[model samples]
Target chain A: MALFGSLFCRLVLGLVIAFLFLPILIVLTVSFSSSAVFAFPPPGFSLRWYASLGKADSMLQAVWLSTQIAALSTAISLVLGTLCAIAITRGMIPGAKAVATFMASPLMLPGLVLGIAFLQAARDFGLRDTYSTLLIAHVVITMPFIMRTVLASLSLFDFAMVDAARMLGRSYPAALWTVLVPNILPGFVSGGLFAFIASFDNYPVSIFLVDVRTKTLPIQLLNQVEMSPDPTVAAISALLILGTIAALIVCDRLVGLKRMASI
Target chain B: MTLARDDLAVMPAAAPARWTFDAKALIAVPGLVFMALAFAVPVLMLVGDSFVDRDGFSLAGYRKVLGDPYYIGIIGNSLQLACITTAVCLAVGYPAAWALARIRGAWQVILFALIFLPLTVSIVVKTFGLTIMMRRDGIINFLLVNLGFIERPMRLVFTEFSLYFGMVNVFLPFMILPLYSVMRMLDPRLLDASASLGAGPVHTFLRVTLPLTMPGIIAGGTLVFSISVAAYVTPGLLVGDRFMTMSQVMAKAYLNIRDFQLGASMAVIMLVISAALILASSYLVRTPGGERR
Candidate 1:
């Protein structure tokens, strides 16, 4: 009975995973097809479609812009978010609890609302269509990940070691460098990965703030998917899926998804 | 104890005269400053924009959104869609979480990995995948047609069914995670206690396990409800604007019509509804310390 039940569970779970990933697998397969239209079991496989992607300069530019934005936004968010996390987690402020809740408010707001609000705010400052507009918007969206993970790590941590280091005459910077940094590195890295991906895949804010030159990958993909149902979109999507999976695996290996979930 | 004296001797002469690095003060300064700039300011401006008009503050945009039946209908649809999706998620996810909780170790890791795989993928890409698979000539329809369940292909792609299918698939992990967490903490010896007291398996589940897991159920259900109410992508692509949720309508109001004030009003309404649900669920979560029959 146990054997049968275990097999059943495996089969059901396997089917679910396959269903989750089937379109991505199909997209990759379709990208290699000689045929222009999307179809399973292509007439013959060819690398021409993948090669043709090189000529789609707009798409190429969008991918480049997305990479830049993700990198820049991640950098900015890391600075602000790390400082913010330390302040909230280690502080003895009267309203620290309220401040923690306030920092997490972005996660609850609908994307449409957030995007519209940012667009309006940017316009008031005459900052629309600039790279800084999108970069700032991405930071707001991604900062929550950093704050949430870092706070969780801090809350679960033992402050006794830090006190001992202090009592032993270690400077604040020295203690932080030696003790806190190593302890929190995993959380920060995982959170940073999530932050980058959030910026990379973001469309709601990007669509409102992006210019023709500043489009991110998702906005570019949306444009293509809206205008033309080409298989190359699938190819790009396949690249993104592969990239995201790789990121997750690296994150798991470094910090472990189990730790992330607890946070 | 001797370390306290020895540490005082080694203390740096240039060390500041503060008792310690003020943990509270340190945490507050940066986080509070950043929150004011990035978060509070933007949302406050959003609310302010909703009330202002050509001359000054007015309720015109709010009136426009509230007075229009078409816009009002979207609120009803948003609530209905969220409720139905929450119910379906609970029904499907409860059994799966239950089954997984019964297993352990390497098998447990694999099951968890399967549940979380979808979350790693982009939401837009996932919606696109559903669009392809649920189309008229898609695999699902092809199979159903071949099996003679219907003589002709059914319109599954641009309907509520497809919307629910996409949502349930996308949000399944949210349901499973909370349920799994709660179930893991449940004491299995209680089952033996119930059985020894002459309770059948069904009775044990209803009277014991079900009540114990309500917190997880409530937590997960609230999450699904809040997300579904504000979701635009799945409905926009799959339902194609024929069935509009408040979020979708809000987006259209801003993007298509270029009515920023009206759009902000709709957004404020959506936020209020979500806040109400959160407060209610948190209240439910707190009111009961433990399970009740």
Candidate 2:
């Protein structure tokens, strides 16, 4: 009975893993297909779609815009989130746990609702700049990821190391820079990666905020899928898949996948 | 001189600490203020907008949402879908999460990475992949037809099945990760003790393991339910106009029709339902045995 149970468990795990990976594999395969339509077991294989991606000016612009938003928001979130994590973990702040929870609450809220709320608020406040509004909204979307990972890292950190450095002729800020920074660097990297990806790939929230002049990659890709229904979007997805693998490899190298997932 | 120096060093430590606030706590102020202004205030205004219109404060939006059968049907449909998705995710995620908890080393890391990889990718990409695969000429139908299992392609896409499949695929990791995390912390000795006490594996799991992992199950369920409830992109792409979910209605009202009042009310209703379900789940988990360590 136990053996049978264990076998069943393995089967389920194998199937689930396959389910998770098969779609991505298909997308990658389809991107290489020479066929214009999305057909599996491509009749012929070619890189024409990838080559055509260069000529798709709108797609290129969207990618650039997404990159800028993702990078800037992630950088800003890292700084603010790290400081917030430090204060919550180290300082004798009242309602620290509540503050932590509140900071991370955006992760739980639906993106559509957030987008709607932001739109309403933007209108109410008379904020007309779409670029600045998007940057701010992306920051809101990205901060929670940074805060959650950094807070988790800080919780496991030993403050005595910082004190120990202070005792050994290093000033307080210097001690934090020397001891704390190196220790929590993995958290920063992983958090920043997650934040950047989250911002870059964000769709529902970005959809409401994006104007004709400024559209993100996901929006552009969706538009392409709707308009052209070709392998071009597949090419983009395949590239994204590669990018994700590289990011995961970096994350695994910095702080093992196990640690990254657990948090 | 040595004794005087020792006294001076100790004096700094022994002096009554200034009752002034810890300035380090101020570090969180900027983040707190940002969330307050950008996140909390916006959500609050959204809820407030639902209650107000050109004719002063009113519940007309809610009345419209509730009184109209079409709108009411959307809410019911959303609830049903959310519930079904949550149940399916938990059922499917359990065995995999169990396997993940029991394993260690490289295989575990690889499996963990595989499960989480979807999360890093865009939902649009995943849904698009599903769209390609679920179409009449897509991989599944092609396989089914070629294998002589069916005479012709089946109507798989733009159905409830695809919606459920898309949602479960997207949110399964959320369920599994929490369960796996909790299960990994299980003490082996408890199972041994249960076995030695003459409890069968099933009996032991029912009484010991299940009870202990209830918190994880609750956490996973809440996460899955809330996400499934608010799901827009997958449903939008997969089912399209074939079905109407609250998310679709809300998006149409707000974005297309520009009915902020109607949309805000719908948003508030969705938020309330999600919050209620989550609270109910947590309450159920907590009240049953209270929280185990």
Candidate 3:
């Protein structure tokens, strides 16, 4: 009975995981199919769908735009989040707990709501649907990841090392730059990775804020899925999966899976 | 001469302490500026927009949202859907998280990767895959058909079932992570003690583990609930115009009807409710019934 129970549990778990992932797997297989209409099994295998991606000019543009936005947003999030983490964790703020929650307020709200708010706010500022507008929205949402990871690092950090550096007459900025950042580099890098992925994968915020020229990749994917269900989307999704896998590997190396599990 | 200059610099040590405030100000500068421009100011604008009309602050938007039965139904449906999704996620995620906490070795890495991988993908793409996979000719239907489980494919798309399916899949990781953290911290010897005292595994789990891990349960539940409540794309893409979630309703109000105020009102309501839930959950976790777990 015990063995039976364990087998049943594993089977259920495996099935659920498969259910969650099978769509992308199926899509990737179908993208290589020679048939005009998409199907589960291929009539013949070919690379025509990938070749067709090159022909889809809008997709190419959207991918480019998304890359630019994600890069910029990740950079901004790293800067802001690190600073906020330092401020709150180091007791630079009076009400550190309240301040931390305030910093993470955006997480509680939906992306679509944030997107619309940014859109209306941009209209007011005469920057509607611009790259800067989307960049700002992405920055807001992604900053919390950086803050969370950095905060986790701070919880494990040693203040005595910094005190010793200060006692040796090392300047405050110098102590922080040399002693503090190196120790926390892993968390910072992991946070940056998260920030990049968040910005890249975001759809709801981009949908409201993007224009024809500034449409992000996910937005383009949404448009494509709406108009036509094609295998090229599968190709793009497969590319995204590859990118995510790469990011996960990098994160594991930097922060360790144990730390991530704790997170 | 250099020694004399250094002595002169040392004489002004008092000035350095006075300038320490500048460092504090500098440290505070970046985060404050970013939040103000990107978050606080934008949300404030949405709130402001919700109240104002051509004449001034008016009841026009509120009246339209509240007075219309269709709009009221939309709000009800969104809340109801969110509540159901949250409950289902808790049910599914609790046991899975428990299992993960107990497991070891290669399986742990696989489970961790499996949970985290979905998080890295774009919501649009995930929903798109779900859209295809839940269709009449989709894999689920195909399997059912092949297994002779059903005579005809059920209408799964554009239904609440797909909405819950997608919600549970997307947010299960969130629930699992928290529960796993809490459960791992639990002392296994306590369970052993309970078993030695004639308690069975099920009884020990119910009495000892469940109560002790309630903080994790609350934290994960709140996080999942709030997220599901405000989720737009999954429900929107899966259900389409068949149903209106609060977020989707707000989107349509703003996009299709050109009712900015009404949309803002709905958005504000959703935000307030989500905030309240978070506050309540945090309170529960923090106090844990006025005793530490």
Candidate 4:
């Protein structure tokens, strides 16, 4: 039984590893399929689908809108999350752990629930602006990712450097900038990148908040699949795979993937 | 992940904050107040909406959601899907995480990328990829036929199997990451000690490794269950109208039918279920046998 159990475990894990990569492999394969339809073992190879993305006016617009929301929300979340992290680390707030958990609670709740709540809240508040509402919702969606790493980084940070700097003659702000900022830059960078990606890919909350003009990439991509079953979506996925590789390279250089993944 | 961070939050109270209110602490207020307004108020208002409609304090929505068999089945579907996904993820991820924790150097980086790469790609893309691959003439069907496993293409896409398959794929990383983190901290010597003491592989695992990784199991389990229960895009794209989950019902309620009351009730139930799972998991961690690391 023990041997069986162990073998079973390995077999499942091996299959799972393949399971993780197979769809990605297939998507990459289908993108270059000369066949317009989603046929495996393509009739031939071509970049027609990749070329098609340029003229995919709606997809392009959605990408641009998603980019704007992700960047802005990430910037906003970094500031907000970093401040909260600092306060949690430096402050005497009782149940600061609970507070930290509370800050990250948005993640534990369902996006659909949050979307519904935001929908009702926006209507009740008479917040009619789609772009701003979507942005606000993205901020909520992005917050926990920011908080998790920033807090993790802050916990690992040595604050006595700031105190020593303060004792030497630097003002509090100057002490923080010189000592604290450089030390935690990795955390901020990792957190911000994760936050940006989270916001960019968000669909459920954005779905409720997005009007016709404003839609995130995930929503737009899903619409494309439901509307037009073609290789264009696969090409976009392939590009996204490349983008992720680029991001991974940047992360590996800046902070090392180990540190980023650990957090 | 939060387990260690919970310690981080607790560690600071020993030293400071007793002075005249540190102005630095005020920095946290903006985020807090923003959450209170943007996050808390909205959820509370949603709960309020569930209780009231055009008829000033009505249970009509609750009646429809809880009292109707169809809505009850939808709730069951979400729970069933979440339970199955969490179970599959745990079953598959535990050994992967175990093997991962034991790996060193170059191989770790390669495997890590393989697992984490999909996460970087959007869920829409991942789910879409699954749909494309599961199509009648998709890669999966083609391979199965070529291998003589089946005579011809099977209708695989809009089935319960694909729904579970896609959900497990999406959520497996979440399970593995937490388990990997926890398992990496285990002392290999402990396993050796157990073996030396005549504990067989099963006994060693159950008595030593299993006890040690309980927190990871809970943490990963809670995280997977919470997200999978409320999954929207996965079910919507994979199975579509063939299956009904709470999220789809809520989306239809709010977006299509504009039934705020029904959507709000659904949201409340989901929140309550998630909150219970979180609380239960945390409570498990805080208990004596499952003490925090």
lDDT of 4 by residue, B32-65 (tens): 8988889989989999999998979999999999
Best by TM-score: 2
Q: Model 3 misses residue B116 by how many Å?
A: 2.1
For model 2, how does the per-residue alpha-carbon lDDT over B91-175 read when each residue is reduced to its tens digit?
A: 9899999888888888887788888888888888988899998988788889989999999999888898888888888889999
Which ten residues in a row are the worst by lDDT in model 2 chain B? B14-23
C-alpha DockQ of every model: 0.44, 0.57, 0.46, 0.57
Lowest summed lDDT across 10 adjacent residues in model 3 chain A is found at: A1-10
Interface RMSD of 1: 3.7
Task: Look at candidate 2 and tell me the lDDT of residue A256.
Answer: 79
Cα displacement (angstroms), candidate 1, residue A141, comes to 0.9
Query: Where does candidate 2 stray beyond 4 Å?
Result: A164-172, B1-21, B288-293
Flag the better candidate by DockQ, 1 or 3.
3
| Predicted chain A of candidate 2: TM-score | 0.95
lDDT of 3 by residue, B1-293 (tens): 34334434665587755455346547867887879877899999988888888899887887888899988898888788878887887877776776677778898788867866777677777787787778787777888888999998888888878888888877777887888788878887888799889997688767887888898889888888888888887888888888887888777876789788888888877778887997888777777462264
Docking class for model 4 is: medium
Candidate order by TM-score, highest to lowest?
Answer: 2, 4, 3, 1
Alpha-carbon lDDT of model 3: 0.78
lDDT of 1 by residue, B1-293 (tens): 35455447656754432344453356456656766876678878989989998899999988988899977888899999889989988876776776677778888777777677667677777777777777676666777888988887677888888888888877777787888788888888898799899998778878888899999899889988888888877787778778988887777777789888888899899888888999999899888656643
Clashing residue pairs in all predictions, respectively, total 4, 0, 0, 0
